[model samples]
Target: MQKTNAQLRAQARGALAGQWGTNVLIIFLSVLLGGIISGIFGGMTNFETGSTQASILEFLVDNLLLFAFTYATYFVALYVVRGGRAEAGQIFVIFNKKYYVPMMIINFLNSIAGYIVGIIVFLPLAAVIGGGVYLSLVISNGQNFGAIADNAFSGVAIALLILLLMLVFLVAVSIVTGVFQFAAWTKMDFPNVKVGNSLRYGWSLLKGRVGRYIMLQLSFIGWYLLGILAFGVGVLWAIAYANVSVAAFYDEARKEIGDPV
Candidate 1:
């Protein structure tokens, strides 16, 4: 029998919630790998000279590689170490050995998918934000405040509306992207799933199971809630649990029907 949505979600959440030690281990390491990659990106810090520069060139250099390294590195790391079979040191070794070529290829494809969808859906918002900041600058500096301020309320209102829409759009996209991409990781590493098949298969799986996907994604919220409760030390624990849960999603799901192949 085909699984119902609730069934699927309950299954996914069960892994995330019920498998305490295993879930905690995956999450902790994934977060650690994420931080390692993020720190590498952060090392390219940028300094902006006030007023004279149109924008900081440093920002481009600093974050140009961030998109790839951030999402794809931990993705591959987790994929390679999917089941709880691997120990902590083993996962670290997996991260070291597997990251370069496969991650580049995987992340490049992901970036292409994201850019195509993101630009179409978000170009208007980016244009508006760029225009708003320019307007703000012009109104405050280049032009008289009184003249623009007469219509400033209207401009501010429009900007706020645009910003809010963009924020919601981003969140929705992030959740969906997270689902498909994480699924892609599983499909790529699993017996039957070639990298090419991963995206198409993942999209199909995620579409019919959006609610379950959302529920699993929201489990991260509990991690955050705990982080808040513990003055941030809990975040470390939360990360490990979340990573394990992510790994368990595929492992546990496979148990239901063996390998997809």
Candidate 2:
């Protein structure tokens, strides 16, 4: 039988216990290392004095480094969940061609998907909002102030409704995208697998369990809230917990269904 959300989280907490230092250090270094690279690039390029090509090069390098650290974070998460001694240096360890190539491909694919979805979802929204504003202005033609003021109540109500719908769509997109949670782990576990195949394998594991996977993610909201309450320092611990928790979820899911051959 597959593990319950509670069991998966318990496993994560167990894995993290007495090892919070290592786990948090890995997370911290992941961010710190990325920021350091960006800072170095910025210092060299000096955005204000840099040519267009220099600025573009900096942007590309920065994003590449960010993607590298992201993959390393998952690598550490998988290591911790599987009873390995995760070290902060592993962040740099996973930055090789073997992992970097696939990480960039995955990041590119996800970015393209996001752009397509944003365009599809927002185009109609933009049209509607633009048309509505134009129509309002036309209706309030002769007496702009009085007519708009008279309709302000209805306009505000409509704006609020549109904002609410946008929020709902954003949440739905996030949940749907949860299916890709294990993509990096998939690549790590099967370095021989093609990047596209790795993503497909990950989706196969979560084919019908996205709801449960998202629930596990939602379960961390309270802890995240507490982290925010603690002057934002505790979020580091919360992030470490969340990463390992999802790693545990991936491990169990893989065992339940086995991996791609």
Candidate 3:
């Protein structure tokens, strides 16, 4: 039988019972490294006044640094799940030559896919709404609606149609990508597995359990809000708890699906 979110969370708590110090250290180092990366390249946010090349460079650097730290955290979570001793050094595991490029490629593709999906879903809706508002305003001013429709409304209608097409595309992409959401952990847990194969495995494992995964994440919202109430200091503990719980879920999920971890 599949474990409940409560059961998974309880298992995480048990795993973390004597490991607070190590987990905190891991969080600290991960934050420190992320801050340093952002501090170094964050200046590129002013690319509005800079060249196109500068903007592109900034974008690449930002995503690369973000992926590095994110993949590192996943590595730490996997280590904890596998019952390895947690150490601050685990946050740097992404720097190891063997897995760095593959992990980065996986993360980059995931991000690109999400952005494309977002654009496809929302861009057309935005254009239609914008044009409708403009037409409404013109009509309110007692302008010639027929002339306006001929001159401007046609363009707006075409744009809306394009947007509708994009929205359908986005829906299709989301369904496919949602199925492979757990591929990253699969890659970490089974290092020898190819990326495509890992993603296929993840899709199969999570095939009918997307709602449970989402609810598990939602269960932490209260703790996250409580962390915010505590002047952000509590967020560190929240992050630790959340990451460990997710790791615990992944372990249970693998077993439930008859996949040996």
Candidate 4:
């Protein structure tokens, strides 16, 4: 019952198309509710004549909480939601009873560990390259040698640009990692498997089917891109995106694994 990659894909795609409702619903909810939360606090804008802190307080009050809450809740919803046969309330129940704590711990430790490691890897590289670029730019601009080195604004800009680039690179990496994690969860469900086990399982799964998996994941990239482009209108139908994406991936894997897989 071994499945070639193409066979897995076809099976996954077929399963995905069949179960479009589940992921789509979740995506719509995730996007729309996220927006509603944003809008509620948005009008608390800083109209202070000259005080950035005026808005700063407003941003901190709502955003910092939302920053943590929205994401955690959404993931809980996604994880517990199961997206197949579970009701929303059941999903919430799963979140409250079991998943909330462990996932939080696993997610938090991983996040902190990853952040520290990433910074350790990235910062020195940025410092050297960014400083070099700024210095080289200043020298090329025919400035005096002292002035070139002392161009604080240009140095700051260069550093910011490098930081922004790092953020983008990391964000992309984080997303693929997330998909890998989610795929693992889907495959294993809430069985007796530990997080490490799930992660290792996911890595093995990805190794053999990266091409098909990437294709399956990209099926929902449209929802994200469209959600951005349409100023959020696209979020309305995004549930299908999630439903299909997850289904396609899981279904494809099932096909490859055959029967129970």
Candidate 3: clashing residue pairs, number: 1
Task: Go through the candidates in order and give each one's C-alpha lDDT.
Answer: 0.53, 0.78, 0.72, 0.51
- Model 3: residue 156 alpha-carbon error in angstroms: 22
Best by lDDT: 2
RMSD of each: 6.5, 3.3, 6.0, 7.1
- Name the 10 consecutive residues with the lowest summed lDDT in model 2: 172-181
Ranking by lDDT: 2, 3, 1, 4
For residues 1-261, write the lDDT of model 4, one tens digit per residue. 545444544553454454445544544454555567656656566455447865565555443333333333234333332334423333233244355444554455445556675776577766866677586676678556565555534667667867876865565555456544553354336456666655555555566666655565565566678877888766644544443344445544544553322
lDDT of 2 by residue, 89-131 (tens): 8877656878887878777676666667777766776776566
Reference-based TM-score of each model: 0.58, 0.85, 0.77, 0.54
What lDDT, from 0 to 1, does candidate 2 have?
0.78
Residue 142 in model 2: lDDT: 40
User: Over 4 Å off in model 4, which ranges?
Assistant: 1-25, 31-86, 90-93, 113-125, 133-180, 183-190, 254-261
By how many angstroms RMSD does model 4 differ from the true structure? Answer: 7.1
lDDT per residue for candidate 1 within 168-259, as digits (tens), equals 66667765566556555654466356665665555554554556656765767877798879988677555644544454554444455454
Clashing pairs in 4: 12-252, 23-239, 23-242, 23-243, 24-239, 24-240, 24-243, 25-239, 254-261
Query: In model 3, where do residues sit more than 4 Å from their true spots?
Result: 42-54, 137-181
Per-residue lDDT tens digits of candidate 3, residues 1-261? 778999888877777778867886778777887778766676646555468966676668756766667677667766776676788777878877776877777777777777777776677667765677587667668477655545654676677777677757755564555444467777776788888887788777766876777677778889889988999877877878888888787777788786533
Model 2 misplaced regions, further than 4 Å = 46-59, 137-159, 162-166, 169-177
